[model samples]
Target: MADVRSMCAIGKHGQLGLNGKLPWEGTRAREFREDVQRFFEMTKGHVLLCGPRTRRSIPQFAYADRTIFEIRSSMPPAETIAMFPNRVIYIGGGPPVWSAYASFIRHWDITRLPYDGEADRFFDPAWLCGVRNGN
Candidate 1:
């Protein structure tokens, strides 16, 4: 596998999103927005393995700079890792995709946001339960 990595912004209790969107919906969150921009900037020159949900949520202007691959059941995570040999590959999916590819991911960069609200999506608990190749 290549330098496979993942990134996520979680709430106080690991809340990822609510209804396919960021948890901070009603209220404005400048920090979260800045962090998201940081995500785009940092992964600009890298490969992003994004599923349908993630691919749709991306900003329109971002498509011009980064290299994003729509990964689904047809193309397994392992196959994507194999396709990129010595480059960085960022997994830009939610809990399900992250859980499915946890073992193959080398690093996880999780940011804790200061939002306390109900969320339908959350960070994978398994990631914290077990040690990966590197934390």
Candidate 2:
């Protein structure tokens, strides 16, 4: 089996996106991007998955083979399991996708940004995931 991981950009108020975009700048934003890049590099050959919106959110994902799952509630779990059966999957999404697959996820790489703004898409605090603040 392959390793599984996920990443997302959240703003100060646990918001994931504002106007369909992440709101972080300067060092925080750069550091988040760099951390994601490192994750992609470390799992170069594995699959990186996300919903359509999440895929759209990322402006320029450097990985050549990033895979989009485009999650559908009607889809069966077996089908989801089949897509990345033996490899680690990294999901970068806003909310819908995160809620859908949180139970199956093994690890989370969340970035804590200053909560000075709001996001239409907010990350659920119920997940209770700890942050490994990146650079």
Over 1-135, each residue of candidate 1 has an lDDT whose tens digit, in order, gives 378888888999988878778888545568877887788878988888877887887778887877788888567667778887877899887666776678777788888889888999877667744333221
- Candidate 2, residues 21-105, lDDT tens digits: the string is 6655344556666755675665566666666666676556544656545566577534675677767677556566566656566
By lDDT, the best candidate is: 1
- Between which residue pairs do clashes occur in model 1? none
Q: What do the candidate models score in CA lDDT, each in turn? A: 0.78, 0.61
Per-candidate Cα RMSD to the true structure, in Å, reads 3.5, 5.8
TM-score of 1: 0.86
List ranges where model 2 is wrong by over 4 Å: 25-36, 60-65, 128-135
- In candidate 1, what residue range of length 10 has the lowest lDDT sum? 126-135
Cα distance off (Å), candidate 2, residue 28: 8.3
lDDT of 1 at 21: 82
lDDT of 2 at 38: 72
